[model samples]
Target: MPNAAEILVDTLIAWNVEVVFGLPGDGINGVMEALRKNQDKISFVQVRHEESAAFMACAYAKWTGRLGVCLATSGPGGTHLLTGLYDAKLDQAPVLAITGMQFHDLIETFTQQDVDLTRVFNDVSVYNVQVSDAAHMENVASLACRTALARKGVAHLSIASDIQEQPADAAKRSKRNRPAHTPQDMFAPHCLAEDAELDKAAAILNDARRVAILAGRGAIGAAAELQDTARLLKAPIVKALLGKAVLPDDHPYTTGGIGILGTLPSQQAMETCDAVLIVGSTFPYIEYYPQPGKARGVQIDCDAQRIGLRFPVEAGLVGDAAETLRALNKRLEQKRDGEFLGTAQNSMQKWREMMHQSEDSSAHPLKPQRVARAFGERLAENTILAADSGQNTELAARHVDLGVGQAFGVSGALASMSCGLSYAIAAGIAFPGRPVAAIVGDGGLAMQLGEFSTAVRYGIPLKLLVIKNNMLNQIAWEQMMFLGNPQFGCELQPIDFAKAAEAMGGKGFSIERADDVERVLDQAFAASGPVIIEALVDAYEPMMPPKMPRDYAKNFRKALPQTPNRDLIEENVARQPAKTMMEAGE
Candidate 1:
């Protein structure tokens, strides 16, 4: 008979989970032993921090539409998984988090690692439970996995130490009173809106002369359908940050991203269009969207709750993005007038030219945009790009051009730091032979630099582009623009990230001058094993939005005299479109 720990591992294998990311501790000795015994069935990836394990699991689920599993011990180890688990919860990724508890008998007796994990995980998990009996181990594990996949969120199961070591009870398992065995394979149902609903949506869309389409993460696998619909409607597709890879940036119909990290053309299209079709996007910036009654709206989302959550829609179609778009396309009339899309495309071209000028700057201190551009140009066709949350995200959103087979993601919704490296590591583990890269700001990378060793230990060939500015550039700009205050408490001491990577048994490269950006990135990308390219960037480079708010300009002007390096900040601001476009109205 198999022990409860073995039963849990076997259940995971039945679900076709290929890898489990976690750290070992005394409380999980039985589970660790079971994993060691079944090494050939599944792979165990040991990470430095429990947080990284969770982040890796979330990223794994995001890239591959499969259940990502992560494990941790009792107390602090289990608690440490909260941040990353929340990332999965907010991003709607399917992940199973297995945690160990203290002995079954000593759970509430002030044991060394006896924390109430169920209560702690309640908010983050779609299904949270603790296993008390060995006979119920498989049942609980199966339920957790099913619920996670069904809900597209986190599922947690905490096993007691004593129960983990106990043998499965054959008598209890064979009892007819037990529930029916859950199937190993699960598939998403094909959901589509009713014919009348589709007709209503199609009528609204076909009546409008100037229409705009907004795509989000739910539209990921529907690229072909999305493009076909855009062509039929003569609509310009504006992507959310998470949906940046839905359509390539250089595509003729795409206006790129929206919101703070958006292109000028995307913002202009949203404001001017008479009608909007929002596909699987919950873009929160209400100010950037077409005013409430300005445009007749239609929205599509897999989850019914998210439909019309951001913008008021005349037709709220509840179904899969691709299916709904395909059905709607059949009903829509092909627009012969191409003026709206052509005008948007022309604005996108101008935006691209301005961006190229920034990327080709010959300044003494390297521009971060240039680094991102070089990194994007060097990526392989199948490379997966993970971007950290900061100014680097802005740079990547604008400059990184994803190719046909490429993938890109950020800690969307949660916007957590320290997730970039873990995401890259997970991508490498999931795809193996394919290339993976991370674009991280200095502050974000400093949060989880220890994970570099995890990549080195696993021999994952990861290319890291560290944009070194020695400051929390995003927060500083927000203080100046949003609060009418000078930057404060945002400065960071400089560190040689290249040297740090070399010390951790990985290859390292540095780029100080603007001319060295391309050569260093090429060398780092071509290097065997893991490599880090730390590029020193100018700190005063502003992350400007496409259309600057009036108050933001007033605030920035008020803080200029008090701000450090005002000349450099002003110089960069002059080159941005915000100055000329501000008076055009928000």
Candidate 2:
């Protein structure tokens, strides 16, 4: 008979798990051995850190809509999985995390790596349990996978080191009766809104002269339906960051992303529209939305509880986004008035023109926006782009124009750093021959630089664009804007990222001059294996909001006098359009 660890691996295979990302440790030796024996059945991806394992799992789930599995040892290893597990939880991705605990007899005796993992994972997991016997392995593993898929969140299982080595059929000899086996089959029911609720939402949408649609990650697979709905309502579609690929940035009806990392057309649409159709997005920026009583609202979401959590809605359609939108489309009448959409599109055109000026600049130290735009222009048809948090996210949100068949994602709710590389790794592994790239800032990449070796080890061809600004640019700007404080403790010593990548057995390219940007990027992307392109971006390039707030302007002015690169900041700020295209008498 197989051991308990073999039983666990078999159960995972039954659920169709193709790969597991993790690192080996003494606590998980049995599981590691079993994985080695079953190498042909289920692949093991060894990451440098346990955190990256969890992150890779989360990204795999997000992109493939399959259950992502990760494993680690007890104590610090289990604790390291928290950030990525929380990212999975907050972003509603299905992930299964397995960790090995101390020996069964050493429990509560404070042995090495003896931390109680189930209790540690309590808040982050939808289902959390510890296996006390070998016979319970299959049942526990099945339940974890089921719960993760059913709830679209994290599920964790902790197995004692000794229990993992026992015989799989140990329960047959014991007096304890075995529980019924859980099936591996999983399916999502097609949920739709009631006819009455659909009618109410349709009426509100049809009655309004100017309608605006805010699409989030929930609207990802419903692009055709969303486009049809937008065309019928003659509405401008504004995307949240996570939903950046729902509609291409160049789509005529789309005004691009909303909020700080968004476009002026989106802000204008939200401010002026008479009705709002919110789909699959719980964007937290309330101030960027229409005033409470100004516009009638209709929201579609899979979770009923999140319906009115962000904004008051006249109708809440609790169902799948595509199904609800398709049902609601039946009730909506085609709007002939093209004024709202026309004006928004015109503003978008002007905004793109203004953005082009920045992206086409000839500054000595390259502008971040220019790098992002060049990268966007070079993306392959099916490339998966992962962006790290901070100024890199802002740059990508503003400059990257995703093409059809491409996908984009960031750490939406958690906003964690060091996720970009892991996300790209997951994408590379999930789709073997597909292109994968990560846009990351110098500060963010420094946190998980070891993962570059992991990419080399696995032979996953990941292209990473590191914006080498040598500073925590976002936090520095926030200090000035929010506290009127001068830049302090934000500067970073420069490191040659290209050289570092070359040392890790991967191709490396560097871009220091404005003229070298396109050539170096082309060379990097054309390379056979993993590549890293380190672009020396201007540190003083300001990451301003689409519409600068009065208080923010005041604070910026107050902090300017003492800022280190005040002259450069002022010059860059002056280059931006003083008013939005709509506000500039367009």
Candidate 3:
């Protein structure tokens, strides 16, 4: 029989979908039944929340280099998927969203939680299709997959309730020989002075006292290639946190990701470098980045328009980072006279030392930095770290040393709050068997802590460390820094997270004093289900040493005529641990 649900599943299988993350509901009963019958072909992962389902798909796609698929019922269930979908879209991950719609007539007329799925998702999605009939289901489904994979973003496809129950064609058909779209031809628009621009960029590099490479998320795919280039040029790699995987933190070329919340090395490198190579990332922290006139910039991007759009570019290349690097590396002459590479390597060591010092968790009120680092030490190589926005991301980014197989998930492009729990759920499900931890703020945890119910319902073993400060500390700190004093609206009447977890059938413990943090976390580690370890830290402890106006002014200073000594980084690392150990009374 040609039922719509069978046809949809056939089409999904044809599209090479191996997994679907979703929660079943009445609206999609037919589809659910069909999927259940064919469980051997496609695995349906039952997630607690639709948002986590979507995020899980996104994580799988990002990690496996495949298109992720997520499904949900109508209205609110469908709507909940948006936040995670937006995260996938912004991060350039391929996620195909399937949602069930109510009966056609009931849609706008308000029939039992009916909502306009297409209209709501259109703005947030790269492409959206709402099928009114079952016959064209295969075409629509294929288009949705193609859109998501081709654009590297989110695509939403909605099927009406009635249509899903209709009989489908016996066999699914596909176009094996589809023509690909023509690549953009921007070269014609900017054919002026190509050779001259290359000459200028090369001259800047040759004459530069110090050079630094800034890799954004776009550069993540080409991290190692970029590192090779950086090593050859003797430049430190300053990545954005979204660009976390580009250069391994252990690499001497990595100076740490740059921003206002940047590590000391990133800021220091940006302050002194004469030549900057900008790749893949449209980092919004322009104030922290080198200004247009301050340094010679060479920008590389997939879209030519992005190159030099933010900062003035002395030269720009429009291509994939890996492709561009291959070409750029060809044109460069290595000064291997041991002048640049040696110095940059020495400076990198010093910067890592200083970071270890700052991450020292020895104090009366525990710094989030030390806690995150200690947690990192206890975690496995393949463990997934789910980080929330604001201070959580900052602390995890600066302090967490990722192992070869480890990956950290954060709301980079969307910068969404409360993404921590959802991220953990998806990452945990996608990576199954690997321990997943959510390092979140008290305020951020409250955002989607309701979903902990979902985690408990599924009996997924996930760890959550809540930095409970009894306030929206990041917001309060920002307000204090930018607007004289902290303003209202930052206060959060604290709740006991541990108790809340117990109420929801998960383990939760409320630990206020610093001494009790690790004990609770250790207990949670041993617990079988989702556990919340709430550490009551200061509202804003270790506030990043409060950057002053003078420090800000140094950004505008000219690139120094000499490269920094790498030995300083080694010294910093050597001194930091001993200092932390003494302070920790270890």
Candidate 4:
């Protein structure tokens, strides 16, 4: 007979969870005991905050393409995982958050440590389940990991503390199948010979003189096809925030990411194009699309459910982008000389000029947005960029180059912070020897800074360029825009991140001036181990790079239709300044 905690650990191992990242507590003593005894079976990485633990797990999964696992205790411990899991959900990072509950009998009984774990975690995870009996633990655990991994999302598994201490017959345990890829649709789209579909899609592109390509994160797998499709259609590509860097910024088809905070080119592309092709993206905002009836749409995707999820479509064809684009390319009569794209290309050139001006090192107190641009210039075309939430994400989205074969990992829907280090680690492991770097904010950095150890332990040595703004800059901006006032708990006291890194078994350096950034970054690359380079970036800065906004007034104000329109919204915003919303006004 083995302890229930042992059974759970064994089940996690069987699920192929290579590493566990989290903190320990009284409720999970049994699990901790078992973890100590069976150290080799599953390695544990301790993090400073439960949020960081969750962040690390999400990163590990993203980098490794496996189920990233985390464990925490009851009450506050369980609650701490909420933010990180939400990031995992939004980013589509495959992470598993395992938490301990009080005695099964104590649930909803006014017990001291009891909290509705599933209810609390439901919003943050695609799936959240609580185990009642030992008989079903293995199946549920395996299912949770499999679902998170295969679906590339977050899943939560909670168990009673007392149940973890219960005895289990180790011999009775059974294993379940966990597969990564489903069966592929073998035949190419052209092979189907669907008569009117290809001809119609081809006709639509050929007829439209002014066309736009709206690409999203889903377009990543179809990068080459999308690029070729752009060439065939002569459509300028306007990417979603999550879609940034998929197409090289310098490409003639690249217009930039579109949204409230995006650039003028993206907005103009969406507004002016006569024909718009929605490829592998389900943009959340419909208003960002060509004004109703302004532009006709042709959507190509493998998932039919996503076709008309956001906007009305004149045509929706269910097919893989890579397969569909290749087929569509064959039928597409090369359009008239890139006249429409040429006009847009001129607009893109203006954009390039604006970026250069904004990124000039002359901006004092170094802007993170500028730093990202500068960093981009020095990074390898092969650099793997991993960005955390807040201004860092926005900056990266707007500035990072999609150099030839560069792959970026952002918490697409999850938008979690502190995911950078783990993601960089995972990126390093997934694509070994490629330069992996992450830009994180102070609040986000503090949330899961401990993940640096995982990078160091695994010998990842990923470069970290911390945008130390000492505040929840994103949220603060939201408050500024929506409430017309800044609020409390948005600022943070600076920490010696470099020293902290040394304490945590990694190298740490500080950058005071903007001029020192590139030099320090170069030095960091030469270092032997994982390094944290904290750049004391300017505070109260905008996350999106310095550029003329399509509608600055709209984005800087509360929502037109009033939702939870705050001034700023990004990943990781727990530690804020003590100033009251009232005090911020004066």
Name the best candidate (by lDDT). 1
State the local distance difference test value for candidate 4. Answer: 0.71
Off by over 4 Å in 1: 170-180, 577-586
Give the per-residue lDDT of model 3 (tens digit) for 384-485. 788888777777777777766677778887888888887787776566667787789888888777888877766667888888877776665455444434
Model-by-model lDDT, in order? 0.90, 0.89, 0.71, 0.71
Cα-based lDDT at residue 570, candidate 3: 26
Candidate with more favorable, higher TM-score: 2 or 3: 2
lDDT of 2 at 497: 94
Of the two candidates 1 and 4, the one with more favorable TM-score, higher being better, is 1
Q: Clashing residue pairs in candidate 2, if any?
A: none
lDDT, residue 376, candidate 3: 69
| Model 1 lDDT per residue over 1-586, tens place | 8888998898899888999999999878888999999899899999999999999999999999899999999999999999999999999999999999998888889979779999999999999999877678867888888889999999999998888888875425556436437666676767799999999999999999999999999999999999999999999999999999998878999999999899889999999999999998887778889988989999999999888888899999999999899899999999999999999999999989878888888887788888889888998888999999999899889999987888998899999998999999999999997898889999999989989989999888899999999999999999998989998899999988899899999999999998888777778877999999998999988877788888988898899899988898888777745444454444
Cα lDDT for residue 579, candidate 4: 18
**Count of steric clashes across candidates, in order:** 0, 0, 16, 17
> What's the alpha carbon RMSD for model 2?
2.0
Model 3 spans with C-alpha error above 4 angstroms: 110-114, 169-207, 303-305, 336-358, 453-461, 502-530, 549-586
lDDT of 3 at 422: 75
